[model samples]
Target chain A: MLETAVFVIRRDLLLAMRRRSDVLTVLLFFVIVVSLFPLGVGPEPALLRTIAPGVIWVAALLASMLALSRVFAQDYADGTLEQMLLSASPLSVIVAGKVLAHWLMTGLPLVLLAPVLALQFDVPQNFLGELMLSLLLGTPALSLIGTIGAALTLGLRGGGALVALLVLPLYIPVLIIGAGALDAAAAGLGAGAHLLLLGAFLVMAAAFAPWVAAVALRIALE
Target chain B: MLEAIDLQCTRGERTLFSGLDFRLRGGELLRIAGANGSGKTSLLRLLCGLLAPAGGSVRWHGEDIRRLREEYWGRLVYIGHANAIKDDLTAAENLAIACALGGHRVAAGALRSALDQLGIGGSEHRPARVLSQGQRRRVALARLALSEHSPLWILDEPFTALDARAVDIVQEMIASHVARGAAVVYTTHVELEIAVAVALRIDLGAAAV
Candidate 1:
């Protein structure tokens, strides 16, 4: 099982590396969207600082969603998904590996880019760490939960839009807590509680999302 | 051994097949012959435990496959209508990933040889998207060359996009596999040239529920 998971991760990462443009598009989308917020809202430092956490978190959510739609679609189109379901390893194990790969491809980049984007918003140096930390914890949950939506909508017409509709509602708690942590930090309040809650969400999502996604994939294949 | 007892299948409001019964033991080959929309693919899926039969059960070695699950899948190699090839990846990369997912981590050298055997030699580095349909199908069929140890092979339309030469290559592979005491269950509209001793052909058009 472990070997299968590692193989899947390696395969997906290799595929992503070969198709460098897809990854770049998601990264550029995140950067562009975050940058546009400042231009649209004007250069009022206090205003940008106050809105930084929410704007960045929302952009991360959208960027991850864009990546999530392709998570299973390509595999489904090529019949790799059926082969995956038939593998010797349990379906949930493969699903978990794919979700982990998705996080690495999409979520991790946003977390890495958050600090740079946060700096553009003039977020305090001390609070920048909180923004990155909150994203680091929360984005995995987004990827995990978003995978369920991606699987549910696999192969459907207009699936990309439908996935966002199904998943954005589920993302509210993570977004609220992730952004709230940075806001609390900026207000001299301890961000620990929000960060801990985000971590808890990650744990919950990691435990159950793969199994749900597996079931959804089976339905989609049928 | 693989056996299906009174297998029934329904999609939406239509019943595809019912009371389907068959058995495949060592050194046997069962051909599921059917017209389009006659549930050939569904039966293959049911045998592999990908789709649940509305009635009855499928068993491997006398144990229900649903209970055996991974143990059963570990010994089975299934290739469906979709070649499962990634367009962005090379032929060699596609084979490596497919073999790995099927619990067989083939070495680069082995992958190249397998592709070569399937008549796709020296094109391992080209992305699958650039390959012709016949070449792509050969890449998918090359899994058979790497999967000699698996006990059962479930293939759906393995000859769809193949040229005459490729078709003969596939037939030779299947014949050799059955000659070696392994079992094969496949769906094909065209007649297979396999010469196994215990060949059974069921035409689904006449066996509909």
Candidate 2:
């Protein structure tokens, strides 16, 4: 069963590798959105610093959502989703494998790119580490939770918009907790509790989101 | 190997089938026959646990298939309307991954042989997207060649978009599998004749069976 999950991850990663543009699209969106914020809001150092956490977190949220449809839309269209459901392994394992691959393709880039983009907002040197750390902790949760919306909205006429509607509301606590981590660090608080909370969200989302998404995929296919 | 007890199916507001019952055992062959939208594909989906019946239960070896999800699924092969091939991957890669996911063990050279037997032998190296509609269906049907040990095979429109020779090859594959004590269930518009000893048909569109 673990072998099946590994195979799914490898297969999806191979697909992503073949379509490099898809992976780059999400990363570039994160970069471009963050870059525009500094321009739209103007680069006053204190003001930029004040809105930096919120702007970056929101961009990450939207970027992750933009990539969410890729998680299942292609497979669902090509009928691989049916094969995945009928696999000898449990659906949850396959969902986890796909979710993990999605994070590596879409989520990991955002985490890796967040701190560099933070400099655009004139974020202080000391706060850069916290911005990256907060995203690193929170992005996987975004991918994990985003998959449920992807599954629920699968095959809908306007599933992409529906995914944003269904999942953005679910992302509230993540936004609060992730942005709070950076705010804490900027205030001379160690960011320990908020970081821990983000980790907790990752863990909790990891445990339940795959199972929920698997069930949704099953019903959607049915 | 499989049984449907008073199965009922509904697609949205319409009931496609109800009071559907059948028994299929190892070494037997059953074909589902129906007109379009008469629930031929729905019955196939229900048999494989892809669609839950609106009523009753589908069982394998006396246990509800829902409870025996992986256990039942691992022992069976199902090829639905979609080929499930990755257009970006070679035919070989597509076959290899599908076999692995279906829990069928493939030897080093078996993937090539499976494609070979299906007449797509050397084309295995080419990506599936370049394959014609018939060739793509051949690639999907190649799975039947590799999964000989699976006791049950459920196929929906297995003959769709295939040439006459390809159809014959698939029919022979099904006959050989059934001869080896593996049960087979399929739905197709094409009339089929198999050399196998046991053959049955469920005419789903004629009336609720």
lDDT of 2: 0.91
Report the poorest 10 consecutive residues by lDDT, candidate 2 chain A.
Answer: A37-46
Give candidate 1's whole-model lDDT. Answer: 0.92
TM-score of chain B of each: 0.97, 0.96
Candidate 1 chain A: worst-modelled 10 consecutive residues by lDDT: A123-132
DockQ of each: 0.84, 0.81
Model 1 spans > 4 angstroms off = B206-209
What are the per-residue Cα lDDT tens digits for candidate 2 across A75-142?
A: 98888888888899999999999999999999888988888888888878999888888889899999
lDDT by residue (B73-126, candidate 1, tens digit) is 999999999999999899999999889889878889999999999999889999
lDDT of 1 by residue, A114-212 (tens): 898888898878987888899999999999999999999998999989999999999999999998998899999979999999999999999999999
For residues B96-201, write the lDDT of model 2, one tens digit per residue.
8889889765775999999999998989999898999989999999999999889999998999999988899999999999999999999998887977898999
Top-scoring candidate (DockQ) = 1
Q: What level of docking quality does candidate 2 show?
A: high
